[model samples]
Target: MLNIVLFGPPGAGKGTQSQKLIARYNLVHLSTGDLLRAQIAQGTELGLRAKKLMDEGLLVPDEVVIGMINSALNDNKQAAGFIFDGFPRTVPQAESLDALLAQHDTKVSCMVALEVAEEELVTRLLERGKTSGRPDDQNEEKIRKRVTVYNTETAQVAGYYAQQQKFHALNGIGAIDSIFAQICGIIDQHQPATSESSRQATDEVKA
Candidate 1:
């Protein structure tokens, strides 16, 4: 399976690219925000706990988030792969993710970092604020805080993956198609080859 981690600051088109990758590669898309919302909507115990933190405008605790991810992985194990978005925003979470995947006898195939100019991100975010009515986008102070927090917390996670030789950096400042093409290129180069012969061999063993 071609597990991929999409890493970048807010407004870097991480969600957009993840959607595209999911469609093209038949990957299970796991966005932490989506997971939390689904859990809260289902009114699960973890959901209720996370909701309290979110209601208080605090980040969800790592254990809660990682537990949610583990459940998602189990549910989606039949998928050909997974594209992770908006989780692992800290080194500890990244390390935990490594441990989780290791237990499944798989690991992250790649971590793609979206590189964009700060001014461009800020400008795009300001425009999105008016259009999307997202509170985090509406205030410059909050937007800056979000970006700063991303840098301080998540940026170092890239180094962690880099040491594992699974890091790939791509320019985020480009036409959407161009950026996507670059990402697809990386995917093509790294995905494992699982030919029909291999499939038949595995099936024979199961039989």
Candidate 2:
């Protein structure tokens, strides 16, 4: 399975790029934020706990998020691969994800990080807030705080992946298509080659 960890600070275009990557690669989009929202929507036990924390302006526990991810993995057994967005925010979380993927005999093929300037991120987020109506995005102070938190906490996860030689960073500036093409180039480099027989077998199955 071609698992990818799409890493970046908030407003770095992860959501937009993840959608494009999913469409192009046939990968399941496993976004922890989306998963938590779904859980809350369903009023699941985990979701209720997460909701309470979120309501209190606190982050959900890593275990709860991992449980949701585990469920998603189980639910998509037939998926060609998975694109993980807004997840594994800390080193511990990244370690947990590695262990979890190991259970399925798969591993993170790469971590693609979008490197954007903080000023650009703030601008993008403020513009997004105009329509998104997300209070956090509307406030410059909060936006900067979020960026600081990512730099101090989540950015360390990049080093973890780098140690494993699976981290790729790209400039997240310019047209969306151009950035996506660069990302695709990175993913293509890491993508495993399928033998002709395996390709034929997959085609036959599709047929």
Q: Which stretches of candidate 2 lie over 4 Å from their true place?
A: 41-58, 194-207
Against the unseen true structure, what C-alpha lDDT does each candidate score? 0.81, 0.85
lDDT of 2: 0.85
Residue runs of model 1 more than 4 Å from their true location after superposition: 39-58, 194-207
Residue 86, model 2: lDDT of: 82
> What 10-residue stretch in candidate 2 is worst by lDDT?
198-207
Predicted candidate 2 versus true structure: per-residue lDDT over 1-207, tens digit per residue: 889999999899999999988877789999987788778789998788877754443467888888888989999999888999988899999999999999988999999999999999999999998997556768888788888878998999999999999999998877888787777767766776744554454344334
Model 1, span 90-207: residue lDDT tens:
8899999999999988889989999877787788888998987556677777777777778878899999989998889998987877787778767665765845554454344334
Which run of 10 residues does model 1 get worst, by summed lDDT? 198-207
CA error at residue 56 for candidate 2, angstroms: 7.5
- TM-score for candidate 1, please give it: 0.84
Number of backbone collisions per candidate, in order?
Answer: 0, 0
- Cα distance off (Å), candidate 1, residue 186: 1.3
Return the clash pairs for model 1, or none.
none
lDDT of candidate model 1 versus the reference: 0.81
